[model samples]
Target: MKEIRVGLIGFGTVGSGLAEVLLAQQERLEKRSGLRIRLAKVADINISEMPPQFGDVALTNDAADLIGDPEIDIVVELIGGIQPAKTFVMNAIAAGKHVVTANKALLSQEGRDIFAAAARHGVEVGFEASVGGGIPVIKALREGLVANKILSIMGIMNGTANYILTRMTDEGIPFDEVLRDAQQQGFAEADPTYDVEGIDTAHKLAILMTMAYGMNITHNDIATEGISRIEPVDIEFAREFGCRIKLLAISRNHGDHVEARVHATMVPERHLLASISGAFNAIHFTGDMVGNVLLYGLGAGKMPTGSAVAADIVDIARNIATGSVGRVPPLSYLPEEISDRKITPMEELSCPYYFRISAVDKPGVLSAVSGILSQHDISIESVIQKGRKQSGPVSIVMRTHTALESSVSKALAEIDALDVVAAPTVKIRILEEDE
Candidate 1:
């Protein structure tokens, strides 16, 4: 048996959980892999309040001290953000240490430079925990599905936003109310901008695009629309029409171009992703060889994320013992092999739409609404008119067939200009059953 010495940075939620799992599963890991995983040292901003589980292990306030430790064979980084995390990883690689990280933001933003440094140092960068927590989607893409050309990837990446949306749909609560509840329950952050504004999902999508389609993505390149604008009324309307509003991170290859985006989507109730509610995560992958495959599990939390990190630790330990650390590229493709295909713009995206028009109940109102669609060359598939809810106007829901988003915007503009219009039209894209 071989012993692998470990250095951990940041004993926050994820870091502490990693320590817990390693301590609890010590016997099983050694029995299964014939390797003893030892925590040689732990580093955090404040080392004075170290947990009792840390036992007699060495502790330090400076992270670089752990990276430079001669006995540490692997360094696990869970201290997220761009600044010192990036600096720490680079310095660890420079010291000839294998690295495992769960920092998706750092990888998505500066993966190219990090991968280049790892190549120069001849070390493996294991980051399975970055994307879908314990779901193993990264491993599936890089190894299991390597035989196929991925057609598309649509994921429910943010558990916080998903929990809020699911509560709004099931409990008939407003967005703000659900968000407040999520925060109180610790499911959401004090500043929920990253989760609700779609920036967090964008970071995950950038990583997925690199592994699935072999493309380098900058966070700015993705067209992101958040769930902040989604309302309970929209959720009710979606349920009435066999659909659910979910914040989806989607990426697809279109000839020489790729479409990568994160937005509030209306997925059909029958779709597998629609059934995934609360703080769980799920992703549907369409591959040429395997067709549609779904990966579902706890997206985040201490134990789930820690399990993923531990798996990587086991892998690196086995490879180290064999003296043959494999060279599986970080992006799963050589830099020269990745294509320079631009992400398709939002205007080019084509999908059906669910439009709810608040207008005065009067003669010729339906004709006026239909006329606007015709002017934009849009086609309406169905229409539902609800009874008057208020004195000012009533809601008229219209379902349209596949149409370009640019045409939908044009039709919406024209509809809002009518004399009968009460407020801005509420429009949500209607995802197809198969898509």
Candidate 2:
């Protein structure tokens, strides 16, 4: 049997998991693929206590040793971030080694240059593990759904944010409390700015937008809003309005522009996406022919991500055994075909909104707010000021019809300036998709 040699970098959680899975499933994978897969080397700055099964594998502190090795057929970079990871991947492709990575941050931000280098070298780069851990959405979009033009891509891509929001909404726990619990359970990082603040989702969304729309879009193009400000009161308000709050990464192609945004969105109770709970991930895509498709699975964690990475490695091995390298362009489409479709600015994005205004218990306050919204062409769909009478301040919840984000922002500022409005107004974008 032809042997495929693999070199793994960054033996952390995901790297360790991949090593363990490969060890346990090597015989089965080889039997199924009719080729042998061997993990020849592992590299990391600080190596941890690995299981005894990997004792024979060469362990090293230097990345150059693995990348420069002529016997290595594939180099898997689990060392995330932009700098060294990008440099390592680019070098591996130059050295004639196929690359597989779970680094969404680097891929979304710097994929254009990396994929271009892979194309130039006539090598392949696999990032099936980059977006949804073990969901296989990448393969679906790049290959399975290749026959159709994808209309939209939306999902709960970040598990940390999803856990936080899911716990908060389901258990009625406060955001801070739920986040702390999630941290204790290893679902969230100590500093979860990327996940909770929506940067992580933006990264994944950028990669999805690239595959779905064939655009060279980056995560920076997304307008991000975190769930940190989401209070239990907001959850209660959503429940009252028959909606659920989820931090959604959404992107779609308009007639002339693409819409990319990440925000705490109001998903209806009846929508399938509204029920995706806990630290799980789900991607819903609308293709021209398929209409709608939803993928759900663990979006993060060692085993799930390892499964995704291993699948990519095996796919690459199969491609190598068939002598068809670079068979699929790095981003699913041909390198020459990736377009530079523009992303619509946040100001131009239009959607229904749920707003909570904390104001003094005074008459005519609703009228004043309505006047400002009407001036901006925003019409109120409904309002609820029930049971807030005897208080120093009251939160009046309101829902608006579809309106441009810029107009809503301006109207919100005007509403916030009123003396009757005691505190800053809160706004959550409503998900108004048809069934």
Candidate 3:
């Protein structure tokens, strides 16, 4: 059997995992693919800490060494960051080597240049593990559901955020408290801003949007909202209304435009996504032909993520052996065929909302809030005014049907202006099953 030599960049969490998978599965892979997969070289910022299993394979602190290594045929990049990782990937592609990466941030931020470099060299770039850690979502959107028009995708993409939210809902704890626990338990990073702030989900959503819609998009265009503002009261209120709150990464393809947004949403309790707990992730995609399909599993882990990287290596090796260069389009369609449509802004999104308002227990307050919604042509689906906990403040739950985000904002603004209301309104997107 011909051997496919691999060069790995960034021996971090995912990189080390890749090494373990290839070594452990080498025998099984050789039987299945009839090819020997070898690690010709590995580049990391700190090579001294690499586990003993790395053995005698060439190791270097400099990434450039791996790009031009003659023994390396396919370059697998797990190095996360903009400058060096991008430079290494582009250089590898320019050197006429196939590339595989799990760097969704880099891809979502600068995929255009990376793909161009691969196209120039007539090679393929595999990123099946980029978006969803273990779920073959990139493959699903790119190949499996190729014939169907993807209507929308709703997911719990960030495992850290999901873990925190799940704990908050189940244990009735505060966000900050659970985040500290997550860090201590190794479920979150020391600086968890990216995952907690919705930036991580935005990157994943950006990649998914490109694959599903064949469109060029960036992380900046997506409307992003973090879960920092989610209150436990809202979670209890959601349960009372038969719902659960989860951070949702959403994208939709309309006839003329595409909508991308990531935010905390109140999904009904019966919804599949709402049931996902802890660090697990799930995504529901509605396609014109396939109707509704779901993919759920460990969104991030050493072994699971490593399996995805190994799968890409097998693909690259098989393609090389068969004398076939290009496999599938990088963005799920030909470069020139990618869409140029704009991503609809958050203010323009249309969906129902769950609002928690604190109002003074006085005459005509409910009518005043309803009047504001009616003025904006936002129809109310239901309203619950809780028993007054105090004479000055009360909690009200208002559920509405589909309406424009701008209209909802305006209505909330008007409702806030009333002297009876105590504070600004807190709004959570409502995802209807049939919508």
Candidate 4:
């Protein structure tokens, strides 16, 4: 049997778990793939704290040792971020070594350059663990669903954001409270900016869009909105409408342009995406032939994500064993076919919206608000006026018919400028069941 040596970098949570998987499952992997897959070396800044399972493997602080090694066939980069990770990946590709990575942020931002380098060097790059952890969505899009045209991809990609929203929805807790609890529970980081602010989801969405639509897009191109603004009252209103609020990373392919946005979306309670609670991640895909397919699993963790990394390693190893490294293009499309498609501006997209307006508890407040909506051609579907206070601000919740986002913004601006309006109107887009 052919021996394909593997070098792992960044022996952190995912790297350590990958080491365990490759070491523990060595027999099974080799038997299944007809290749001796070996975890040959690991590189990290602090090698003194290396795990016991990797005692038999070589360890180093400098990543160049692995990249320079002639026998190492693949380099798996788990060290995330843009700086050294990008440098390491480029160096590995330059060395003519197959690369596997779980860095969504780096890939989403610097994928074009990395893939270009790999193409130039006649090597392959496997990044299955970037988006959905162990969900294998990448392979599904690249291989399983290749026969069909992908219509849309809506996913709950970030575990921290999902956990906070799920807790807030189920327990009626406020956003800040749930966020604090999530941090204490290790579901959220100390900053929590990337996950909560939808940056993390946007990164995954960029990767998904590339794989599905072959669109040359990045996270910066996505219009991102976080869940920090969501409150218990919004959750209650969503419940009243028989829906749930989830921070959704949504992308749709129009023939002319694509729609990509990450925001808090209200999906009907009966929808599968709505029912995906807690930190578990789920992606709902609509394809021309497949209709709707849902892939659900833990989006992040040591073993689950590591398993994804290992799957990539095995795939690359098999390709190496067969002398067919670039059998599948990194983005599941020919390099020349991937082009920059126009992204539909968020303002031009039309969808039903949920609005919570704080207005003075007076009869004219509704008339003023409705007049603004009517002027903007935004028809109201339902209205619920919460408990009133004498000449004090009251919450006036309204669900509008399908309205252009620009129109909604214009109408909300006019409405908020009214003297009776007490606060900026809270707007959350509604995802219809059929959509």
Q: Which consecutive 10 residues in model 2 have the weakest lDDT in total?
A: 47-56
Q: Single out the weakest 10-residue window by summed lDDT for candidate 3.
A: 47-56
Query: What would the TM-score be for candidate 1 when compared with the true structure?
Result: 0.95
Task: Report the Cα lDDT for candidate 3.
Answer: 0.88
lDDT of 1: 0.89
Relative to the true structure, how large is the alpha-carbon lDDT of every model?
Answer: 0.89, 0.90, 0.88, 0.92
- Model 4 over residues 1-435: C-alpha lDDT tens digits? 888899999988899889888888989997899988888888898766556766668888889988999989999999899999999999999999999999999999999999999999999999999989899999999999999899999989999999999999888999999989988988898999999999999999999999899889999999999988888999999999999999999999898899999999999988889989899999989999989999999999999999999999999988887888889998999988999999999999999999999988867888888989999999999999998746578899999889999999999999999998888889999999887
In the predicted model 3, the residue pairs found to clash are: none
Q: Which of the numbered candidates is closest to the native, going by highest lDDT?
A: 4
The lDDT-based order of candidates, best leading, equals 4, 2, 1, 3
Worst 10 residues of 4 by lDDT: 47-56
Candidate 4 off by > 4 Å: 388-392
Give each model's clash number.
0, 0, 0, 0
Model 3: per-residue Cα lDDT over 1-435, one tens digit each: 899999999888898899999999999999988999988798887766556777768888887888888778999999787878898888999998899999989999999889878888899899988877889888888889999999998899999999999999998999989999999999999999889989999999998888888888989889898898887888898898788998999888886888899999888888888899999989889999999999999999888898899998998788888887787786778888886787777778888889989988878888888888999999988888888755669888899999999999888988998888899888999888764
The C-alpha TM-scores of every prediction are 0.95, 0.97, 0.94, 0.97
Q: What digit string (tens of lDDT, one per residue) describes model 1 on residues 48-94?
A: 86677677678899898899999999999999999899999999999
